[model samples]
Target: MDSLTADDFFALDLPRHAQLIDGTLIVPEPQGNFHSVSPYVLAQGLRRTAPGRLRVRRQMCVVIGARDVPEPDLVVVNASADGGPCLMSYAARDVLLAVEVVSPDSEERAQDTKPRKYAAAGIRHYWLVTMDENNRPAVHTYELDPHTGSYAPTGIHHDRLKLAVPFTIDIDLTEIDRL
Candidate 1:
């Protein structure tokens, strides 16, 4: 198919899981239980104490430009704008954080390509969560550099993910359940 405009993509009545990346529509591979629930766990954790302005959403479609609308595993955006939206999509500029949980189905996209798009779109923070052999979520975080238009590695989080951006929180990875 030819490259599609945002309107053309949305008007296709594509499934919710469909995403437009660089003008191509791709459907993410099927998710497992862990992939599905991790978002809920993260959302639950973030919303527990998030400030009113920030809302945590899973599989939130983001408009990265006219031809891309990739949905990150989780997104943190300003709730106060657009009457406190908790809906279909948000502009990339409104995104404060974007998280992608790595699964075998789409490892490279999560660890590589998606982060590039997120940073290029000027999203402030991006995280890639991958599971180890023993079933631990190892988080690699990134921060966008305005000067270079790229992302700089902040840290790789293991047992705990302590953050001061997109709100402050110290998450105990072991405490989060995934089945």
Candidate 2:
């Protein structure tokens, strides 16, 4: 079969998480318990802490290339994205941050593919969250180095996640347990 364009993938009427990467359609498997709740907690935390000009959304698609649209666990974008008609997907350039709560099924994509794509598309911030041995959220953050058009390791937070770039972020990852 032929590869699907981003438009082709997005136009489809589907009810669950999906992405178009390298011109192919990808439907992520149903998330496990932690996977389901962590993104929600993170999004809520960001919404409360981020500057008012930014907006936080859960599981929104970002268009990185003509055939690449990845629905990150959460996306942070400038308020301008909200001023228009409700968007089906936000352009990569409009995204301030792309976050992934890595599930077992998504480790490879979250750690590698998505970051590479995000950096190449000029998305300045990328974060990957995974459960530590004790089943706590460990946030790994990266910032784009425009000179090289690649991401640089910013920090890794264990019990709590904090950052200065992309707006001051302080999230008690433990909140994931409340769900």
Candidate 3:
């Protein structure tokens, strides 16, 4: 971790996906087709609301703390005015929101640990997207709690995932399944 930087992480050519947290590498659990569906739907839906000002990036490495550079499933950031290439890395402050889609293999970290890290990094919003017992697209939105420096659950949605934070938008849960 002390020896690695955001640039180093990007330069590596790994055989599979990995994330760098606290100087260690983490490989995500194998996922099925359903795990990929929600991210695509949410990214597309958010893009419709963001229009020309915000950029929605999927699976980009984000530098949170000194050694925490995890690739969030999706991230929403302010678009660059120069209109050049997309950024290679984003500091925590530049991120408006980070979205993580949970799979069976990621239950522990996604639910129990990642939110704390995101909150500690001062990310204003975090959404934990998962499949519920009924297999519906479940989105749980968290906002940073300034006093405690932790995340507070602001909203949970199943059918119509709507929120005013980050931006006002309505995401159809069924669309996630259809996609």
Best by lDDT: 2
TM-score of each: 0.91, 0.95, 0.88
Error of 1 at 2 (Å): 1.5
**Which of the numbered candidates is closest to the native, going by highest TM-score?**
2
| Tens digit per residue, CA lDDT, model 3, 52-125 | 77789888777897767887889987786223565567778778889998887777778877777888889888
- Give me the runs in candidate 2 sitting further than 4 Å from their true place: 83-85
For candidate 2, the per-residue lDDT at 70 reads 93
Q: Would you list the C-alpha lDDT of every candidate in the order shown?
A: 0.81, 0.88, 0.80
- Order of candidate numbers by TM-score, starting with the best: 2, 1, 3
Write the residue-wise lDDT of candidate 2 on 26-112 in tens digits: 889999988888888788889989898899988889989998999999999988877555677899988999999988888899999
Instruction: Give me the runs in candidate 1 sitting further than 4 Å from their true place.
Output: 82-86
Q: Which whole-number lDDT from 0 to 100 does residue 34 have in model 3?
A: 68
Q: By TM-score, how accurate is candidate 1?
A: 0.91
The TM-score that candidate 3 achieves is 0.88
Clashing pairs in 2: none
